[model samples]
Target: MTKKGGSKHLKRLAAPAFWPILKKEYRWVTKPSPGPHPLGRCIPLLILVRDMLKLAENAREAKRIIFDGEVLVDSKVRRNFKLPVGLMDVVSIPRIDVHVRIIPHTIKYLWYVGVPKEEVNLKLVRIENKSLIKGNRLQLNLHDGRNILISREESQKYKTLDGLLIEIPSQKIVQHIPLEVNKLAIVMDGRNAGRIGRIIEIQEKPGMSRRKFLVTLEEASGHRFQTILEYVMVIGDDKPIIKVSEGT
Candidate 1:
């Protein structure tokens, strides 16, 4: 019988726009199927290990390392080479004592940020959806494709686009940072991503077909930029709840 379902190979030129690979370098690349993150926003685990991180020379080596039970994503060993590792997902190689968090890169649309081993358990998830469930429980749908339940009263304090510092495995929310002016934020999408800044102003334009909000971010170097509200993720009130320094 002929094989069916998703194709394993994708033309390099036809890959998603977010893919950082050079289209002319190779004719084909692995197309990661739907996993923990949306297809357009994620890269295959093999590509991340072999191409981006340069940890392995080829796909075979990457698979070997994964199958050896040496690769952990969000604190759980992941053997699937095609698994999607997207925004804010923690990838750790315990054997090498290397840990990284995938974030929007200032140059690449998405890039990996080296994180301290102690902070590997910390994750940032944006609240994308919420709904009331039975027993007065409120279900929150995070951007990471995770569904977590919180009390209705607690849900009332959270809104879409708010960032949460959650602990891995336990999935406990350590802090809640609201989206507002003067708050520390990070660009979660677009070219300016991974840049830490503070919200200087929020502009809501009226008389538009759909309501739109734009935020002005002032970087630590006294530089400023603007981005749509959806691109910003609140990280803290006074300081980041999790360590985000490059060397940390």
Candidate 2:
């Protein structure tokens, strides 16, 4: 296929899995259009950026370099997330000593993996091999040499314990906050204080807990802040509802 034709193919494959878009904006890039009409011919751009960052040992440091004006794209300083960058775009980073050429791609999962047929972004955006070794009794491997494992409960569900339909998006439960959106349950010393709050974000701190859920917990009643991951839940809907404390 010609270069132009190849781009069109990549766009079709990547549009649904990565970027949340309904229709292709190929017309937009090839023609004149308005703000954010979706990447016209930059399907490979997504793969390039993702791969570049994935190789980085420290994502925070990488982000700092990207935002600190140390990176250049196509002989120009490019920081904007939305650009018509394609597989041909050249990315230069001074601090990390890396140059990236974007490529088109698809989502990857572990062995015995399958995902929902829907086009929604997979919940687990990233998973490395042997990341969940030793059955459901082990923690999740952060792939960053971190042991940010989920609780046995969360692991069991992710391992198809209750026959929960595991989707890519659902895998992202680890990264996403345990909020009402994902049916996250929070407890303190075996006490339920309502479905605390919505999980908004997760931080994979080095030398800290494997991955920490940064929650916007809604305390129907209880103490503020507690040791996380000792016990938490992001198992999705139909979990045991708990708000009333024991012996209350």
Best by TM-score: 1
Clashes of each: 1, 17
Q: CA RMSD for every model?
A: 2.7, 18.0
Candidate number achieving the greatest lDDT relative to the actual structure: 1
TM-score of each: 0.90, 0.24
Output the worst ten-in-a-row residue range by lDDT, candidate 2. Answer: 108-117
Candidate 1, lDDT over the whole model: 0.84
Cα lDDT listed for each candidate: 0.84, 0.35
RMSD of 2: 18.0
Write model 1 residue lDDT over 136-206, tens digit each, in one string: 89998988888889987787799888888999978998888778888998887766777889899988777
Q: For candidate 2, lDDT tens digit of each residue in 65-121?
A: 555667665446755533444422345554556554332222210001111223122
